[model samples]
Target: MDERSALGLLAGWVDAAGDDAAVIDGLVITTDMLHARTDFPGGTTRYTAGWRSIGASLSDVAAMGGTATAAVAAYGAPAFDAEEIAAFVDGANDVCDLTGAAYVGGDLDDHDEFTVAGTVVGRVDDPVFRHGAAPGDAVYVTGTLGRTGAAIREFERGNVERGNELFRFEPRVATGRRLAGVASAMMDSSDGLARSLHQLAAASDCGFAVEWDRLPVDRAVDAVADDDAARRELSTFFGEDFELVFTGPRAAVESTRGALGAPITRIGRVTDDGVLADGDPLPDRGYSH
Candidate 1:
């Protein structure tokens, strides 16, 4: 069978989860990054996905509760000669340089699609796994959700307030750095909150009790879709969120919240009840691109 394609663009991040730094050491590579970059700035969008690849992988690093220290990205080209490939590398290099990460090295993979592969190296004093959540740990998130996916939906629907907030993802580097061991379990939620929570619960062998009413929504998104159905659609399965969802003891959670000096609403708590809302059960689903 041809190499299987996944359901969503964000699925790559989920697949790269789990700890084995030694195994992933220098070999963690991505073919999609090069493909996206080579087509951009000259494609229909007229902008390469090189930077986007950086942001996406960086977000993955944050989700793993680590900060990217360096990255090695390579490109595959069929038509463009060495010069064009060099420009692509330079462009990607700029992203790494700006983020204080080094461009180490990587090889090229030539194929039908112009491909880009980015292998990132990160460091964490304490690796944040998907599990480790205790029964009473509270669920919290940094920043709001759904704006990026909502923008995509709006763009596809023939309207274009197209917010680049999610597309040009700003990795929560500092946030991840600070949250290292603060939360018993930490993850950057590229998928919707529902999905991340569900995954975390399953991994930690617990459930999430959420309060849907307190969800932090972006007004830019809420403005166009004010109805309940639209709001739910935007907030629920809308993917590419890239927000941080971490859990910890109530006291530790409260302390970390105060120290972060940012807004983190306690959307729920982990329990054995299996992701509840008040006393009722909730659907633990992730977002799709």
Candidate 2:
């Protein structure tokens, strides 16, 4: 199946069963586990990687419109060292407390590579779904785009240390909450911006026009990628910029921006067909998992 279709399949399951809330409230999973067998600061081989995984997943869950009420997780270890496992447990609970998501339950397994997976449960009053956009609607994105991608690029080049904004993006839980009525369709851009836009456009059965010149590049990123041409180049296919993208009528667009109180950039317009920039096709994948 195509990438978009895969995501749609998952979303379909949610929609078919997600009968709890309206435009803003429903049963939603906030986070997914993230891990690093190497390059993690707490000693790559340490148990903290699992903790990072849980944090990353929780971030995903909280980014959507939910309170991150509870979580279920399973952990895999190579040797199951007592100390290492204990540390992993500590990491998990710490994140649970940190994010206000209750630690419901999880399992541990014996394995080679470290692995952690979490399922987060939360609620929304009137849920903002992945489908439904109209032609002539404006597209809005919270915060800046291309920061995570830029951070990855810089990290790869040995440019910065940990704790960079691009590498670790806090979920836009509040923005997602305020977006319900204002946004016709809403989704988190965990994938590249280009791919997420495609998902939103196809779901709404509409088209898009990206203003390549103003993609909200970060300051340090702009200094290096430095120009519209460069930002356009990086923002296209770079992945993991977990920002939020939504679409709505002109009025809804304004209200979302105003209510969210975040820098919402009008990157494009919803169209009658598919993607278009200045009436042309957008190149590259932006962020695809």
Candidate 3:
């Protein structure tokens, strides 16, 4: 079975196991794993790798509307270089600092390839969930999309520095917390917008009517994509943007639009059934490993 099926199996025994993070007694906890081959692109620095790896787990905490307290990583490499190890730690600490958390320390080991497993602990009085959306709620997405796609293109063109910079994204910890106050349902778009929407729909037992023109396509995407179709494909399916996609009552959404620090666009509205883009069915496609 695939990862989703495996998670489903686990959900049968563990309550709240299907969410971005598991919450117990007001503590939010999550973990994530990354590989050098699939996650960190060629020319990616050890520093960027550390940030991306640990930031992923922090994103899970953000999805739960929790304040990250601390983080740790299990790092394994074929052979550890002292300089590289230090750079990794610096990157992890920087990301945690930006998101109001601390990276205490973690384990190290020798392995065939560079790998990182990150765990984050957070706290929240009321955590949001993916299963709480309802029809008529407005669907919102923070920040622009297709940054990772743009970064990949840059990497292909030998713009390693720019590519690495793009790959290093701040986990939307603050944005998620803000939305938590207003969002009925929420999730991170690390698995691509289309797949994220599908997952949210399945969990909430609802659908979405998304307007294609409403998508907040990143400007960098225009530099890499050849045409409108290419732009839409990259922005919607490429994933790795690390932005929050959430839903809330129309009234609540409109009221809080101006106050949110990040730029969030109202791209759609929740519906009774079927994910749609401009009235057409949107394919459930996204990043999967």
Candidate 4:
């Protein structure tokens, strides 16, 4: 089965397994694993790998509108260079700093391949869930889309330096925290905006109608794609942006933008029908591995 389908099966077997993170008491916890060979492209730095892996887990906490507290990593690799290991730790620490979280250290093991398993702990005054969006709610996304997609394309073209700039994404921790009181539903767009909308729609039993013109397509996509249509596809369907996709009252969403002093784009509205882009049906397309 595909990753989403497998996860769906697991969710069916487990209780309260659909959220981005697990909330216990007032703490929110989440984890993620990254395989070096699969997740990182050739020429990717060890530092970038560590940063992205840890940040990915923290992004889940952010999706729940949580304030990150601490994080740990489990690293497995073959006989790797000591400098590479040091750079990896530094990257993890840097990401923790960005999220206002502590790097508590973690276990390391020798293996045939490189891999990282990361976990983050956080707290939220009011947790947002994918299931909370109501019809008529405004759907918003933080920052521009397709940056990672552009980065990947650049990497494939041997422009590793430029690609790294987009690969190392900033998790929307601060914005998410500020949105806690306002947003009704929230999730990180690591799975691409299109698939994310589908997931949110399924969770909330509501659909989405996104405005094509309103999507914050990153200009970086222009460097990778041939035309506007391809750029739009990359921005909407490529994954690993690490930006928050949220829903709230239109007024509250505007207030959130002012409160956080961050870019928040109104992309769509929640609805009773199926997902649509510019009134046309939008497929659930994104990275699934």
Give the winner by lDDT. Answer: 3
Report the candidate with higher TM-score, 1 versus 4.
4
What is the C-alpha lDDT profile of model 4 across 1-289, one tens digit per residue?
7888788888797654678888888999988888867788887888898899899988999899999999999999997688988998899999989889998899998988888899999997699888889999999999999998898899999999988778898888988998997898999998899999999999999999999999998889988999887897789998889899999999977865777746899998999969999999999889774
Model 1 residue-pair collision total = 12
Writing each residue's lDDT as its tens digit, candidate 1 over 1-289 gives 2222343344456654342121154332322243543223222121224555565666666666666787766656566566666655665566666556676667776666666666677766566677788888888888777766566655555553254333444556567667767788877676677677777886788888888787787665675685876776677556566677888887876776666635677887888857776667656555533
- The whole-model lDDT of each prediction reads 0.62, 0.63, 0.91, 0.89
TM-score of 2: 0.77
TM-score of each: 0.75, 0.77, 0.97, 0.97
| lDDT for position 203 in model 2 | 59
* Candidate 1 regions with alpha-carbon error over 4 angstroms: 1-48, 76-99, 103-110, 157-166, 258-262, 278-280
Worst 10 residues of 1 by lDDT: 38-47
Better of 2 and 3 by TM-score: 3
Each prediction's Cα RMSD? 5.2, 4.4, 1.1, 1.2
Q: How many backbone clashes does every candidate have? A: 12, 19, 0, 0
The CA root-mean-square deviation of candidate 4, after full C-alpha superposition on the true structure, stands at: 1.2
Give the alpha carbon lDDT tens digit for every residue of 1-289 in model 2.
Answer: 9755685577676653221122234566544544444324322333345445655555455344555677677877677688877776666676667657676768888867666776667775666665777888888778877766576666666655532434555556566666767788877666667777776776567788877666776665665585667776566656555567778888757855667746788887887876876667865375433
* Residue 202's lDDT in candidate 1: 68
